[model samples]
Target chain A: MKGITVRSPARAAELFHALADPTRLEILDELKEGECCVCELTDRLQAGQSRLSFHLKVLKGAGMIVDRREGRWMYYSVNAEALAELDDLVDSLKQAKRARRATGCC
Target chain B: MKGITVRSPARAAELFHALADPTRLEILDELKEGECCVCELTDRLQAGQSRLSFHLKVLKGAGMIVDRREGRWMYYSVNAEALAELDDLVDSLKQAKRARRATGCC
Candidate 1:
């Protein structure tokens, strides 16, 4: 389960850090099913407008979520391919961990 | 080339933080080819013993790299499965980015 986790350590680290915060993770979850406007996200998320915006900004910065402006409203979507890749990557880690000798060093 | 990247934003952020530091990134790069002992890593890395240990600890904490202690010496190897998963995830991102509409945001 260790070592053989993610390819491109830098890339992995970048991706990991992008979702480091709970708020950001929450935003991704909200968008998992489909795109939603800011109002919809706030109503469903039940968070302050400013706080939600901040989280959205972070997610967007990381390229984990994309938003489009249709007039004053912004619609957000789950980057489905990204999510699929993530599961597969983790699955790969699970497989590698089985073959690898689990080291004690942590 | 934006708003479509790594899956499991949380996982991605974790992996990103693991390699966030230059030292950690360098350590990862060194391990890219194969595993190495602390001494070998130190000699090749030309970094302080304490610093190297700290970096190794961070990488280990994030499951980016693994080490096996054969006596007092520890051999570290890149988790191949993890590496493959990381690339595939990125490729997935590339695909999503290409298909998704580019949106302008702060």
Candidate 2:
């Protein structure tokens, strides 16, 4: 919600829907720095493991996060490929903002 | 999936989940040029009205798209704020890529 504008209005709603939840957004903001173990995430998020697990799983299933097992702990990180797609997603917002200058959309 | 990378791994999953569908992604891609009517989308996507409407509704609910009604036709565009957030999302991916260079995640 910083620099990019809406380029693809149709998909904007659905895109934001994934981020509309406070818990999910918070979880994502937390992961901005780097990968964290479930325990650390739980402490940082102040969320129960059950909830954290669910959120983490959602992120993972979306191909947003990937994990590596270290002994009994699992470490997770973001998917670069998906991230790039997101960049394009945000670019649509930028285009939409510019669309205001052009009224030729069909 | 171009320039941006994942910034928030956890959120990445949630974000991508919002866009994982071919329909949703296609819708977003189509709108990238500018606002388009359901008719145009329907034509471009070669999908039925019911399905297009359903997909459009989903994108709107997700905050990816905003609509303006012109007589009977509905015109939709993307939201820039959400796109910026997406840029940040992709940044996490760039970081993750860099993180690969440094193995000090806690």
**Interface RMSD, model 2, angstroms:** 7.6
Positional deviation of residue A7's Cα in model 1 after best superposition, in angstroms: 12
DockQ of each: 0.13, 0.16
Per-residue lDDT tens digits for candidate 1, residues B1-106, read 3344345666655655665665676676666645677887788779998999998887787678888989888888776655665665445443432232244322
Candidate of highest DockQ: 2
Per-residue lDDT tens digits for candidate 1, residues A33-94, read 45677887788768899999888887776567788888888988766655665565444343
Candidate 2: tens digits of C-alpha lDDT, residues A54-74: 877767765666788887788
- List chain B TM-scores, each candidate: 0.76, 0.72
First chain TM-score for all predictions: 0.72, 0.69
Model 2 residue A15 CA deviation in Å: 10
Worst 10 residues of 2 chain B by lDDT: B96-105
Alpha carbon deviation, residue A70, candidate 2 (Å): 3.3
Question: Where does model 2 exceed 4 Å of error?
Answer: A1-24, A79-82, A88-106, B1-20, B80-82, B88-106
